[model samples]
Target: MSPDGLCAHRFRHTAITRLLRARVPLRSVQRYAGHSDPQTTLSYAQAFDADEAIADVEKLDY
Candidate 1:
């Protein structure tokens, strides 16, 4: 369990989503995820679905 008592996977997704939300750069996420290149980590970001893109669009606040 996480510190917040949520599933550990939730934290994983949160981390990736947080990085995406911060516009931290996919290449940076790649390095952070210890991926050979940005592509691998990119797959993780899309592993669940296109939620990151959806979240970003929802944040438009328009």
Candidate 2:
């Protein structure tokens, strides 16, 4: 059990993150997360700051 009493839920979040990173369909992620609607799954997707992504990309030229 998690300190917040959401042990299983943490795994769900991790699964959702993995699916989002893999570019899986949002609808498919909704089904996997057992949400009745895609919007709910979409809410869990990581929010990317464009500036951060660009900075990270620039660092990859090593």
TM-score of each: 0.47, 0.60
Q: Point to the candidate with the largest lDDT.
A: 2
Runs in model 2 lying further than 4 Å from the true structure: 1-6, 48-62
Q: Cα lDDT for residue 5, model 2?
A: 77
For candidate 2, write residues 5-56 as lDDT tens digits: 7887788888897886776765566678898855566666657455643443
**Deviation (Å) of 17 in candidate 2:** 1.2
Task: Note each model's CA RMSD in angstroms.
Answer: 8.8, 9.6
> Whole-model Cα lDDT per candidate?
0.62, 0.66
lDDT measured at residue 42 in model 1 versus the true structure, 0 to 100: 58
Query: Alpha-carbon error at 45 in model 2, in Å?
Result: 0.5
Best by TM-score: 2
